[model samples]
Target: MLRKAEDVLTTTDVRRRQVDERIRRLESRLVREHDEVPPSLVHEWIERASARFGDARVRDFVPLLVERAVRASVLGFSSDQHEMSGTWLPDWARNTARRLLADELPRRWAHTAGVARRARQVARVLPVEERDLLVAAAWVHDIGYAAELADTGLHSLDGARYLLRAGLSRRVCGLVAHHSGASAVAELTGMAEGLAEFGDERGRLRDALWYADMTTSPDGHPTTVEERLAEIRRRRGPDDPVVRALAINGDERLAAVRRIHRLLRRTYKPARG
Candidate 1:
């Protein structure tokens, strides 16, 4: 659990100077930001969040902090619900990824599509950039299966690291590397640290990614937690490395997912728009 999330905002021992630099560049007209909703719904996010979080000075960072808090809440709640639900794939993440799988591997894409759809649904709570990152991660999650890279046998880590090396955001890299931690795939391949760098440690972002990966199926679709666990049992039979690892940690992980799912659903419920 490398909890040393150094908030190294790009670079600096001089903190305020850095924030001041960004603030100085602020646009004259702040877009009166809203969640990803219709123009008609502009007031909805303000109304809802104001109702729950209440009024505070609408300072420059307040909105971002509030948004981050909302994202964290979503992750926390979703984790809990998934634990109980068993079928814990972050709904949006699973759905979007499922679709990608279907498109790439048409023969088996339907199943994968289900996974993508669920991933997408779960990702909806995130900011647009974060959501895009999640969707991209979910879609390409299984790309390691494509013969050229399967030899390493650590899809999440191996896949993500490759992309990061070429140049991708740390956030995107994080999801790709740690999503589901990919079956002890990292440990087996001695790349867990590298994978962890691509996100997926123990924070809210990691939790959200974790819940998304676990809840979705290899075949890609929503399902009950029991059914999901049963599928794992069936897929691996008994004593498979991945299966063993999942079962050993199943209780804690399931609980995490369930909590996140419940909280996120409430927090991110569609805006009035």
Candidate 2:
């Protein structure tokens, strides 16, 4: 079971393969749909990002990331999915998911990026094996929010289901599905299927994503749980979805956030897994 879990994570192979496949798919799509970007330019970024990550394979995702950015432009995505996906990127998938996120919820794009950035920050604290999934999920955490699929409005559930349908790995799919969990949002959106679909992940990947998202600011900056909650209240007020989410969760979200924060501190303070 232990080795099986490691093999399941696309931590290396599937991620690279997906990046390569995405580039090919997007290039063909662009040709059919009109040029979203130059093939050469997209290739350039993938090459550059690959070099930056110090992993030759990391080079594969750049093309895919750039293609998504161009698509985001076509969609009038205000969120700069390219930038968000690229934030703190280490020569790879950092910006790969941005275009999709941008297409989904430009308003929440920055927030998702912020979560990814924090995931990068905390990567140093996690086991090397777990970091890849954490980073990948960071980029993909909010993919369900795509306007076309934001059906349940609980982006996690919707996004997870979408990836699973697209044939993504169970580990990556699970991470995205329940990154932050929809308990609060699910109560309101009425998406029990998405909620129930997120099965047990093999590692701390889900927990890491949840912790990072809860601590980060929606404006794409870092903040504490105490501050994050206060800001939610101060900005969204009591009648808003977030406020109402809190009400429905019976403060469970807040408390869970608090617990996660404590774990993050202990896990990340010395910066070792």
Candidate 3:
């Protein structure tokens, strides 16, 4: 009689081998589709996707589902990276930020998403390359608050350092390092030296991030600068270091916002007869 498929190998082992083969095929297809993406990066995404299903109770279709997710992620990374170099924040990066903040600090995640939305609204005013950068910065601007990265108690420096280690672009690292006048906080907290390594990426890119951050409230709603400032003070307390830094840098931050708003108004002309 012909041997059954499971006679040679246990059913579980066979299933495992099938999943592995599927993953390999998916990886090959991804490489073909996004030939420009570094092989290492592609593999990293595959590894991450595989890891996510490691503890799952079910096995059937998991590999296929993971492949679909990986494909979407790879396509997003490739498209954005090609358009903006280091400015494109991959799903991995965004997921890392969310994983760090979403459960531990849901409010922060809301604020981050709001800032990203604001970035999207103003994307037309920025160059194509900068649009992705601003959005990436918006998404991860508060990663320092994540418990894993709260070493210095200075989110800006900590977040920037983490991103730099993750092999993100210098501009994105610098923007995260010094976002929304974080330099002023660094000065107050005596972490200026640590932040200096990332340098001040001040300019339109920095200004855009600052505008996106300052105009969004803790609840993730768009608000005027005055209201946002009040919310910060209310949330952090008047004696908080962040509040002190805001007090010191309030004028400069507000000025940056006004400058960006003016640019938007000047560049955006309403359609008319």
Candidate 4:
């Protein structure tokens, strides 16, 4: 029995080291492929994978499964495709976000679509690059709310982390990371540090998304900021953490909404004879 116990311990130690080495190799490969992805993000992904497989009975395949799962979550394109530069959100991102949320959260799907529509409406007021980035952010802003992606229950951070892992542009990740007064809620959740890495997107783009998200109701209809805040309070209740946080930061959020509206009025001009 003593000899058998020693053998078991030896096997376990070797497997643990192997898993560590594999994760290191995976991190190196991800860095090579995604130069913009922060090392901290890569480490977080590996840690999450390790925790997920810690108790599995199949020790031999844990490393392989971890690699596959991490790659699937973070990589959305082939090597050649990643090398190309473009402004538009890829079809795969839209499809992936839709697949993750459409069946499980139909209301969210509708709201995302509505936000995308708002992004489109603002296209004429923004530069080409900004327009595309805003549209991309709108399409995937709420993806963190998807069941499969809600690791921290802070959709902005979760969605941004997933996108960063998938090798999306850092700007899009940043926008998703800090959208819709997420920083206020992040403070309440102890996730503000993780979200700080992405930084904030440009002011115009950030405010554009803020307007898109705040103006649209959960049911996907247009509404004023007052109505939207009321709706959120109604849905989440007075005692909810998000409600409390929003109340504390309501002035800042309302200011952003008003700023975007003013920007829209200044920039948008109707075509006339």
Candidate 5:
């Protein structure tokens, strides 16, 4: 998972030690059950799981949460040191996004579903191996808006940080970080330095994600890019940095949408089994 040990919340030394001991015990039990799995790998999973809940206000149940997360990582799907893979990604993304956004941000959930719908529709434009990446990124691109994960207040970067730490594919995190002309917004907001951690990923994958996000409305309906831009300007007002960034990059974003539409027109096909 993404590394930054210092980012975990500060805790009393006694509580930290107790949590460490409980995780150690959990690792031992896992080692006994899956003797084939390396102890170091098990330990790494525990650490990553623990890091994820570092900011939780209630610390007493953190060990249990870590155990559940580690078990899911180990037994629920085929994953690697820092990437989730296989046919499980889209389903996992949907479930996770629902868990994070359904109750707290219903409107955003609708938007996420709309983006996922658009992604599935356009996935055919991508290679077979890459289709899932687009759809999965679509589902969780707005996750940083979740109350539990909104550390930076910049949704794109905060969401990408959580995705990377949670062991999603780097490509998925990159798409979320740079989606819908986020780089321009980040620059205008003075968050470019923080957002740069994900590295810039361009080309078809990024464009496809932008197409999905830019064409979807806050309430999750399909719309023209111009209409979406108008809505954002209205909601944020003329002086908002996001509106300013859009003013600067609006034409480029429209060009990307048009290019995606042309690709879909030329080679539109439903996703295949």
Candidate 6:
């Protein structure tokens, strides 16, 4: 019985070392990618993933399972899509947003879900190359609202800054910074110049992102642009800086939404008999 107990202890120690080595290798591979995801963040994800398997009887597969889970968390790949190529920005964005906002800001998470859902629907109107990017922007647009990330007190700029450091493309960072007429608000808060760092993007991608955000309700439901605007006004009240910024740029936002509607209508095709 003592020999058996010693064997079990040795087995457990070996498994722990194996898991750590596998995680280290996985971290090295991930850090080589373009984003070069932070090693600390990668370790945190590995710990979270490993925690889920604590009750399992068989420990042989734990290291492999944790590696796969952490890789998915880092690269935003679903289990079936691990072998697939092309950047999965939207998935990464969704995971990042969830990590930051799900526990700390439930309502904001709902809003983000709604906007990302709407962005996916609207992406059909954009060119193939731009579709996922629009969805990606929608996913992380409000991450600055996360309590720990709200450094600038301006969610748009703060969120954009976070994404930029996370190695997101400049275009995505720009969209997050300027979503929903944030330029007017930035100007009001003296952050307009800061926003320019991402450069101003024009045309359909911008319009579609705005349309997705404006048409989604805070509860993650579809809503007309007017209703959505009214909801914000009601929630924030007229004294809010966001509401005040809306007063300045609301018309321009409305125009962008209308432009998207026209584009959608133009692309609409009646069912063929």
Which is the leading candidate under TM-score?
A: 6
For model 6, the run of ten residues with the poorest summed lDDT: 77-86
Off by over 4 Å in 1: 1-108, 183-185, 188-201, 268-273
Q: Output the number of the lDDT-best candidate.
A: 5
In model 5, which residue pairs have backbone atoms overlapping below 3 Å?
none
Candidate 6: deviation at residue 144, Å? 0.7
**Tens-digit lDDT track for model 4 on 164-254?**
9989889889999999888888888788898898888647778878877886778665555777889999999988878988866788778
Candidate 2's residue-wise lDDT over 1-273, tens digit each?
A: 999889877576787777667665665455335322222222333334433453545566576555555554434322212212333333233454576666556657888777776676555445666676677777777777677657667778777777677666777777776555356666566665558776746345555676677666776655555566788789988777657776665354455445544454454212111
All models: lDDT?
Answer: 0.50, 0.58, 0.76, 0.73, 0.77, 0.76
Pairs with backbone N, CA or C atoms under 3 Å apart (clashes), candidate 2: 46-62, 49-91, 50-59, 85-94, 85-95, 86-95, 104-146
Estimate, for each residue in 1-273, the C-alpha lDDT of model 1 and write its tens digit.
233434454333364454444432221111112112211122233334434543344334644544544444334434432211222233444454444444566634554444454555565445554555555555656655444445466766665666566576666666666666463645654665655565455655555555655655555444445456678878887766667667556675677567656655564454221
lDDT of 1 at 216: 53
lDDT tens readout by residue for model 3, 1-273? 346755756777887888888887777667546543333344556777787776567776767767776667655544442234344364565787788999999999998877776776555567886777788888899999998998889999899999898899888899999888888888898999999999787688888888888877786766667667888898889778889998779998899888787776555332211
lDDT accuracy of residue 62 in candidate 5 = 83
Q: Which regions of candidate 4 deviate over 4 angstroms?
A: 1-90, 269-273
Q: Where does candidate 2 stray beyond 4 Å?
A: 1-96, 103-107, 200-203, 248-273
236 Cα displacement, candidate 1 (Å):
1.3
| Model 4 TM-score, all chains together | 0.65
Compute the lDDT of residue 101 as modeled in candidate 4.
Answer: 85
The per-residue C-alpha lDDT of model 2 at residue 258 equals: 53
lDDT of predicted model 5: 0.77
Decoy 3 TM-score against native = 0.66
Say what the RMSD of model 2 is: 20.7
